[model samples]
Target: MWWSLREKRRRKMSSTHLHSQRPKRTMAQKSMKNPRSRSRFSVKTSENYIERMPPEVILKILSYLDAGSLFCFGFVNKRFQELANNNAMWYRFYAGQQAKKKNPRLIDEVTDGLSVVGIQERPEGYWRKQFFKELAGYNANWKKKLKAIHLYTGLPSQTAQILRSLRVRWAVTLTDGKGRESTSEQTHVHFTDAAVTVSWSAGDWPFIDQLTVLKLHGVVRVPLQCPDEYKPGWKSLLTKVKLNKDVWKLCGSDRLVKLLYTEQGITVGVWQEQREIAFIMVNLHYHQLVERSLLGSCVVQYQPAEHTAAFDDVDPEYGLHGYAAHIELHSTAGSIASGRFSQLFCTKDQISDGHLQLKVISKSNRSQHAPLCGSISLPWRTDALQGQIEGCCMLTLTVFDEAQIPFWCVSAPVAMTTSEQAEVSYDCTGESFFVRYEDAEGKVEIELRWMEDHKQYFMVSLIIFLSISKVNKHFGRDYLPQ
Candidate 1:
């Protein structure tokens, strides 16, 4: 009887388990939970590229960047900083910058007090010391590294504040003392300057290449793009630079100014106050850098632009010459005290060409400060004139101050290029001012405006030169004040 009862209970339990149905999942639960059981899908993405890339790959990539870029990159992230600062990496950079030799293994450059190696080994941190030494302006092998300096925009103290990095464009032409010339290499060194960017590079990579901007002190890297905020100001700064190309401002005797690049060579100027005091015009087409080179000796010191020979004749097609009439001097305006003036006339080619005669006129008349009357002439198109040519002419004038120092000088550029606009006919006269200076014909201009401001600075009567060449019949205009 007990056995029969157990069998019935077991049967009842088995039936219940076999026949019972499971409950259906709700829509919310089904949507929220994984569709498949034991799924390994994750919502997060893995983008740690540095962690993914092999260190050898990273190191091979950092070989192409400049030294300044490498140093700036040292602040990126711990990994990047470490990779950028690696001593081996600097060895490659120093090697690339080194002068070539007859033997691939032997080098003349004395880095870290050692010559080239032949299967020899060096301690770690050796290249790092060598890099810093190059920057310290040592290692005379690269002595021609920096030939000229240009003060582009701001003071050196303001470099970090205004620029993203101090982008140094350095090119050296190697030369031996015996006058042998060599084209070395080009280097663009960038450091923190506020105006542009506060970014750094891992030098330039050898193979892998892409522009990048890493977070300031963060590990996340972002695509480097120019800042929108600084673009307009940058454009304006460029315009300002273009306008004040004449000035070579001398700040101090011993210290050199900042550097700016030009197509021909380097120009040194102060960005603020619209000034440039000195410039070293080097024709790299013919010259090389060395301790005692002809080009190095002839650094173009800052003289009043017009007073100097108007030497920036970049194009043979266009030459600079201009004239002013209706002269006016205001005692309360700028730095012109009592002075004497003289003028010279020469054809475009004759100015630079040593063969032609520069028929200069002398005027030693002493003039008082106010209403300092004078007449000036620049030939319009002098085909009939015996000496003057049509294409261009250089009009040079000298102004001696009360102490006979050449205080005010003019070497105005006049365009006589035979275009339809370069008619023998002159522009309207008695406009109180006239100047045409451009690759093409344009009226009125800048260097003169700067000279006016210069006079205003000294709190003396500013000497005014008026241009009415049309009335003067293109020979010379008399000083007529409106």
Candidate 2:
């Protein structure tokens, strides 16, 4: 009986010890019996599930986010902070934004990596800076946002011919009645015998009934047949004009009723020569708004370049056909230090080529200086030469200094057909044609003359007028402050 009792007690004690060793039901497991408690338990366990995901997968997910969202996401955690600040990622993001631009295919085909505005490469933090700049520019209030006002007019056959010969260009400035003004970022105008385009960027807006002013500087003149009331404003070609409240109402109410509104912006075409302006179109919203106001009246048809999606898309097939020529730069006048010439590049539309590295051969080498002189011969019909300028309507030559900065640039139309070659009767002496370009820096004249008969467009001469101010700026001091 004792042995039986002892064995039973031992078995009971062993069972009790095993039960004690087993873990008690956790609070979570105890709550699992209830549906709400089970839901709460799951919520607490999966909080760090994304942190457990593979880094590449997380990045791929984040890639779909915009710049603003990406910036916000950087604050999520340290690991995310590192990924969001990746330069390569931001570059790709910026490139993707560029791809979404209008006619990106053509832009890519022509410029390669060069932007139309001359932005060459994506530097570190450029993406963020551009993003913020665009955001600020586009989202500013009506008074602060950039406004573009375009004025179209017709040129007589005689006036157009004179403009072509003089190579006239216009620079315009817009100031609101309040005195705030903004210069145009880009003044692109394709001058032909028929239509002339003029536009300005407005920084401040004039309220209704205020006098909006336009100050323009150019050498071309159109006959002004203004009413007696408006005669006070019309003067020289380079003069200011103030439009009053009555003229504003007349412009938009009667004449410019048929204004065109497209996805790009609002455009009012007035074919009347007597009409100074048809309407004042202001881009108030992001899309743009067209306000019509008639200045004067007459009907004259004019043909500008073939209107396209973009203004500068003059000829998509320009320079596709091959032509052979020799291009040379000559120092015609003024003085520049020796060894000033470093590189020469030619770009027109989408075509660009680095022509040569120039060496300035001077008669004397001293601390003083000699005539800004250098000659570089670019053989256009060679295996090494990739671009041909034979059929191109226009081309731009940019000369770089020793520091690889643009020292001088000239954009001029090429002498292509016999008509163009004959247009400049004065300059087209023999089988030679000349185009001249002048700016605040200096003047450059390009002489495209034939050598052996008229079989080939043989050679080009670029003569630079080294103005004192330009030379002084190039050398980094006021050497000659004219």
RMSD (Cα, Å) of model 2: 26.1
User: How high is the CA lDDT of each candidate model?
Assistant: 0.30, 0.37
Enumerate clash totals for all models, in the order shown. 46, 9
**Count of clashing pairs, candidate 2:** 9
TM-score for all predictions? Answer: 0.26, 0.24
Model 1 / residue 426 / CA error / Å: 23
Candidate 2's error at 152, in angstroms?
A: 37
Residue 22 of model 2, lDDT score:
97
Q: 1-482 in candidate 1: lDDT tens per residue?
A: 99999999999999888677556677556655865632334323565776679988877777767566666666667778778767656675555446343236544342546444621256555676664544333344332333322122111233222122212222233223343433222222222111111111112211101111111110111112333221111000000112123332221121223323232112222222333222221111101112122112122211212332322333432222332111112111121212222332223443221221222211122132122122222111111211111222222233222222222223232322212332221311111222233211112221111124223211112223223332222222232222
Q: Positional deviation of 473 in candidate 2, in angstroms? A: 3.2
Candidate 2: stretches off by over 4 Å: 1-395, 409-429, 450-459, 476-482
Window of ten residues with lowest summed lDDT in model 1: 231-240
For model 2, residues 1-482, the per-residue Cα lDDT tens digits are 99999999999999999999999998887787788877777777547887889888888988887666776667788988767765545655455545556444542443335553434245545555554433322222322221322111111224433334333444445566787764432233433212233332232334333436654444222112333222211111333456444432111112222222111112222223433222322111111111000111112212223312212232423311111111222211111111222223211332312111122222122232222122221111111212222222223344444333334443322222332534343422346545444446555554444434444332333444445455434444333222
